[model samples]
Target: MSSPLSVILTQNKLTGENFNDWKRNLLIVLNFEKHSFVLAQPRPPTPAIDAPDRDFVALERWDNSNLSAMCYIRASMSNVLQKQHEEHQT
Candidate 1:
């Protein structure tokens, strides 16, 4: 079965023209999922080889959240918008 998030996104695909509304909806879902930190905080730089364990952990969490959030954003975007953003680094 499709996920609730997929259902919401299917109902309100991001078409660029409704960017503000789409962003609001997306933020609400991300926050509810506890993945909003990836967007709220600046990404921590790659931890050094000698970095503390906590640093490594933070980076891992940030990386996971970034990837997950990006996937959700891309999934919700209109096909044209998704293609246009396919090469974006961030």
Candidate 2:
């Protein structure tokens, strides 16, 4: 018999100046992987008199039958994020 697959629960940071573009790319990645996710926005402990805080996209749930898909999603997302980081660095 084969061992059961493990579920993946992870978060992707959504930062920098191009939030909309980053989010759109991440959505595409998730859709391609057929994975459902939740968008988590950072909230301050109290009303911030200054600016807003950081945010993230969380993949907290997955289909147990296809855990391997998460691996592909993670790799693709990592690549996308790295590209975005490099672009911002320039």
Candidate 3:
């Protein structure tokens, strides 16, 4: 099948106003989960800007934590997901 996976890819652009409301908070949680499972594992490492230091490693670790949280949050929405597999011609 050559069909592209039609996943409900939500681009959550959370703002300070969203955080102030409870309903938006739930959406934040829901969106995080959908993003993590549907999408592939995100890259954690960043390019060296000035020099390689512990700060960079710490930043990377923080990003990894965010990624992990995203995956966990997305666990609830796995049922309605649409997965597509590309079929190649031999």
| Candidate numbers, best TM-score first, in rank order | 1, 3, 2
Which lDDT tens digits does candidate 2 get at residues 1-90? 011111221243444555565456555554545443322222223434453433111212323313433343343345556565443311
Cα deviation of 54, candidate 1, in Å: 0.9
Report the number of the highest-lDDT candidate. 1
lDDT of 1 by residue, 13-73 (tens): 8998998888888887787767889887989999889989999999889888888788888
Q: What is the C-alpha lDDT of each candidate?
A: 0.82, 0.38, 0.39
Q: Which of the two, 1 or 2, has more TM-score?
A: 1
Clash counts for the predictions, in order: 0, 0, 1
Sliding window of 10 residues with minimal summed lDDT for model 1: 1-10
- Give residue 9's error in model 2 in angstroms: 18
Tell me the lDDT of model 1 at 32: 70
Best by TM-score: 1
- Clashing pairs for predicted structure model 3, backbone only: 33-74
Which tens-of-lDDT digit does each residue in 1-90 have in candidate 3?
011221221332223344344235434453454433223345445767885687587666656555544443343222332121112110
Q: After aligning candidate 2 to the native by TM-score, how far in Å is the CA of 2 from where it should be?
A: 23
**Which residue pairs overlap in candidate 2's backbone?**
none
Candidate 2 structure lDDT: 0.38
